[model samples]
Target: MDIALINPFLAAAKHVLKTMAGVDVRPGKPFLKKDDLAKGDVSAIIGITGVASGSMALVFTEKCILGIVSSLLGESYPKINDDVRDAVGELTNMICGDGRRRLAADGFSLQAGVPTIVSGKDHSIRHFADGPRLAVPFETDHGAFMVEVAFGKPH
Candidate 1:
């Protein structure tokens, strides 16, 4: 996979959390995801289509979700609920939007689909595409999570 294609998602995620949640996130060196289970309690997956086709997932631990939602809503959500899920979806949307705008400058005009959310212990989400995924793991004061991106050339 191209780091050129993957960097926007990483940048957007870090920028979003820092600007919106007031949280400074440190991203670990990216690695390829090879059928490994996701290390998250909740994940929001968004499809990218148009110039490029594939998906991106924002996976988060329960504590990470709670911390971000608390900053966004000004109230701590003691647990995961429907509201928490919705917040995750919206956060993913924001990151996708930022990434899309950035990718357009790199010649890929991407469109993001409605986010699909899943929550469970070790819910493994396989990429719908046959390409390798570039997984960027992040560490914040709240917890750790990952941003996984797997995309293809423009159609």
Candidate 2:
């Protein structure tokens, strides 16, 4: 995979979190995923095709996502209900859209599909493609989260 592709996601994620959720996210070092099991409690996944044939997953702990929804809506949600799920979907879409826009600017035109959210203890994710998956972890004041991506860069 081209290393350049990951920068868009990192930049977009930081921007989205600070703008939408009023949370500041600090990115950790990027690494390759070593297992299928996810580290977070909830995840929003969006498929990416065209120049990038794969998917992007935004994974968050229960506390982190709930905090995000609460900050976004100006309310408190103690559990992961429908409202919280909807907000996760919206967050996934926003991050994906922002990253895709940057990819377009760099000539990687990708079409993103609808985001699907799944939450449960240890509910794992299998990436869409047969390529190396990159995991970028982020830390916030409230909690930590990460984005995992498996995309085959255009030759």
Q: Which candidate leads the pack in lDDT?
A: 2
| lDDT by residue (tens digit), candidate 2, 1-155 | 78777789888999998998889999999899989888998898888888668889999899998888889999999988989888888998999899989989999888989999998989898778878899999998878899998877422
Q: Write the per-residue lDDT of candidate 1 for residues 1-155, one digit (tens) a residue.
A: 77787899888998988888898899998888888487899998888888668899999999988998899888989998999999889999999999888999989888888999899897888665667888889999999989999876432
Candidate 1: the clashing residue pairs are none
Whole-model lDDT per candidate: 0.87, 0.88
Residue 12 lDDT (model 1): 94
